[model samples]
Target: MDKVFNAITTSGEEGVFQTELCKSFSLDSRDGSRLVGNLEKQSLITREKALYNGRWTYKLVVKKSIPVDAIEQKPIDLSSVEGAPCICCPSQHLCSIEDESNPISPAKCQIIEEWVTISFNKFMMIQQTEII
Candidate 1:
């Protein structure tokens, strides 16, 4: 099972066809199907139906899992909002969502909108760089 799972994972995002995977392990069709079925039941892999060389087959792909420890270790980074307009605005104290009397509400603030747009673009660029 471990070997089968590792093989599927090593195959990467494109995944391996059911017949080919079975052939690689020298297992018969029944055994191979059963093995992959167990993996799918365990939520360790997913099978997609595909046409391989005009023959129907199942494509086995590994499920991506994020470690809980990694999520716990990563802290929320608020540096992106460092230069936001609201941070140093003199009327920040007067800004209110429910009060119609306040003219400095974030909902109608152009400066805040521009700042958010710029910050979002920067965040997207950083995300793309990290992915690369």
Candidate 2:
């Protein structure tokens, strides 16, 4: 399968014919067709009918390549935002202007002010330490 896909990709945008693949890999018509069908089913390639020496034949074209890096992507670490105020706020979901009950709006929210003040104080302390 890899060999067949590699061969098709090597042909680039021009693509390669089913008969060409059969000849190149020494595969029979049934096996070649089955391989192409599988590649099409997986969305790795596309097959289209075209004129080949006065006969209709299929072309094996690569749709897209599976990125090796994408398969091994590093998981995101949200450690920095672990204790953030908005995320920890108990009334966050109920905080809205339209809601009449327990309407903890953002403009006059005490929770946000306290959190911001504490964070600012910590930042100032860090700055003072650096200056000293």
Candidate 3:
């Protein structure tokens, strides 16, 4: 979705972006997924993992049809906002990943994979699998 939205807004009627272009940032394709949304929700046409040239890219549409700046935003104080983490408008409510308010800071993300999912097969260990 992020890719599609970027393709449209960044390129225009051509509406295209290559994931390889992301290499400049050194982003790993399998590290995580990107979503383009107004308030933390993606809408309109979306694409995912479309490898055109040894790269993965997701294409999606923007609901408002506006371009959002990908540059790092200055961290803000989340405590001031009632629903800090739940804020849809980062400009108004959410703080930058650098802000202490951010449970996961941008700096933290850069140093490590902030969102690493580890799967352990408890069934294979000492626990039995149960149907919930």
Candidate 4:
């Protein structure tokens, strides 16, 4: 399954025809169909109907790549967001997504928008510095 997925991934966005893929691996039609079907069922790949050399067949396209390493889980640091404008917002008590008449909603808050813009710029700068 991993080998099949690797082959499809290497094929890029154009993808590989199901018949050709099966042939490359010397897989019988029934087994090959089941293999690709399993991958499709797992959401690892998508099969699209296509006409290749005047013959109808399905093209196997990679949907998502499986990570080689397990991601490290770390506790989120809330201190990083201590300076958020909403933290000390005077109208934070009145803010509500459901209230259409609420004038202090986060969606329509200029202060929050400005804070986000500044924070995003700072974050980008930090990323660029790390890259350097």
CA shift at 126, candidate 1, in angstroms? 52
Could you give candidate 3's per-residue lDDT for residues 1-132 as a string of tens digits?
Answer: 455345456554443443543453354554323433331243553444465666556443234445558655787865333332333434334335556767555444432331221113333343454433
TM-score rank, highest first?
1, 2, 4, 3
Q: Is candidate 1 or candidate 3 better by lDDT?
A: 1
- What is the number of backbone collisions in each predicted candidate, taken in the order shown? 0, 0, 5, 0
User: Of 3 and 4, which scores higher on lDDT?
Assistant: 4
| Candidate 4 wrongly placed segments (more than 4 Å) | 64-132
After the best TM-score superposition of candidate 3, give how far the Cα of residue 75 lies from its true spot, in angstroms: 39
Candidate 1, residue 19: the lDDT equals 95
Worst 10 residues of 4 by lDDT: 64-73
Model 2 RMSD, rounded to 1 decimal: 10.6
lDDT of 4 by residue, 82-105 (tens): 578887889988988898787779
Q: Order of candidates by lDDT, top first?
A: 1, 4, 2, 3
Tens digits of per-residue lDDT for model 1, 17-94: 999999999999999999999999999999999999899999999999998877767678978668988878888888
Best by lDDT: 1
User: In model 3, where is the ten-residue run with the lowest total lDDT?
Assistant: 110-119
- Better-scoring candidate (TM-score), 2 or 4: 2
Best candidate per TM-score, number?
Answer: 1
**Candidate 4 CA-lDDT value:** 0.89
Model 2 reaches what TM-score against the true structure? 0.49
